[model samples]
Target: MTPEAPPTTPTQAVEIVRSRYAQPKLPDGTPAELKVHEFDIGYLVFAVFPPRTDAAGRPQPSPPGGAKIVVSKETGETVTVPNYPTEKAIALYRKNVERNA
Candidate 1:
């Protein structure tokens, strides 16, 4: 198998951006929420996921491995919560957020 070429032009970059931002809605017709907002971490776009719930009706932390983005619907605030898959990545993301804020 051969590798694909990198994006070469501004148009290609825009297309790539659009594709990355595209997401499918859930079965209940609730669209995948992606809210852009101002935070302590400069500007960041948040992709809101279905809230993970417990049997006791509590909101649980998001699953591991996948990226976690936190947001407040009422306040319109957002933050890209670090996905601590690896120690290095976790530290790097945290540091970047801290430095930006």
Candidate 2:
């Protein structure tokens, strides 16, 4: 076994990033922002989100302080995203995003 080729095209990289940033909700009605990529121990991808802070300068339930939704590119899974209340909710969310897009 040996190393595999990395994504060479900008379009491919962009698509990967986009898909990971906006993953569809799970079957159990859980929303996730994950990207699947080949793992490289020396390299990492960081998906940074704006901080969710209050007047008290404390972290809120939403996102985080300069939240970075760091995920394993090799595995499409994470825990920062919200869990949908139901399948209907997931469907509705996807539908709305698609329609708006």
Candidate 3:
């Protein structure tokens, strides 16, 4: 089967991620830096930075120990990313990345 075209502009990727990341179940927030970065593995990841109360409304500095995780699952095998939370969101991101990779 032939693969379809990837996103022609960043807007498509951004819009796709924005909708998924803003869902009610997951947290409602933006990264402290408020940036959506493409992962080396080809998926977009963003952080919902802790809220800021300072005059500027910028989130305070935070340590990024949670940026990646390494643990054994119930299968007793280790994985970098945990099980899928949003299958559709993940599939969309993967489809876009495959074009570039």
Candidate 4:
């Protein structure tokens, strides 16, 4: 796919997150809880919850992957690297937030 323009708003960021993690909602087709946070690690990390998807495929309230987007704070800049734990990404995001604050 061709590169897209950078998102200038949190709503746009939500749209970006939903593109990959579609079908996110409750069993009754209601919207689920979603969130966006401050930027860090050269990126912005947004979480799109699945209503009930946990790390082990359990129907829990939280998940660790396939439900997050680490968009660069600037164009084409990624915070995550290959073969790293997702916790690191979160850490980096928090660090950047701290730095920016």
TM-score, each model? 0.35, 0.25, 0.28, 0.47
Instruction: Compose the digit string of candidate 3's lDDT tens values, residues 1-101.
Output: 11123333334444444443443222444233323333333333344554545578866754334431111111111112332233444455456446645
Off by over 4 Å in 3: 1-5, 23-60, 65-101
Query: Each candidate: RMSD to true structure?
Result: 11.0, 14.2, 12.2, 7.3
lDDT of 2 by residue, 1-61 (tens): 1123334443444344455556445445665443322233111233323456688999877
Index of the highest-TM-score prediction: 4
lDDT of 1 by residue, 26-63 (tens): 64876675544333322233356788779998999875
Q: Candidate 1 or 3, higher lDDT?
A: 1
Candidate 4 TM-score, true structure as reference: 0.47
Using lDDT as the measure, the top candidate is 4
> Between prediction 1 and prediction 2, which has the larger lDDT?
1
lDDT of 1: 0.44
Query: Candidate 2 vs. truth: CA RMSD?
Result: 14.2
Give the better candidate number (3 or 4) by lDDT: 4
Off by over 4 Å in 2: 1-6, 9-12, 19-43, 60-101
How many collisions per candidate?
0, 2, 0, 0
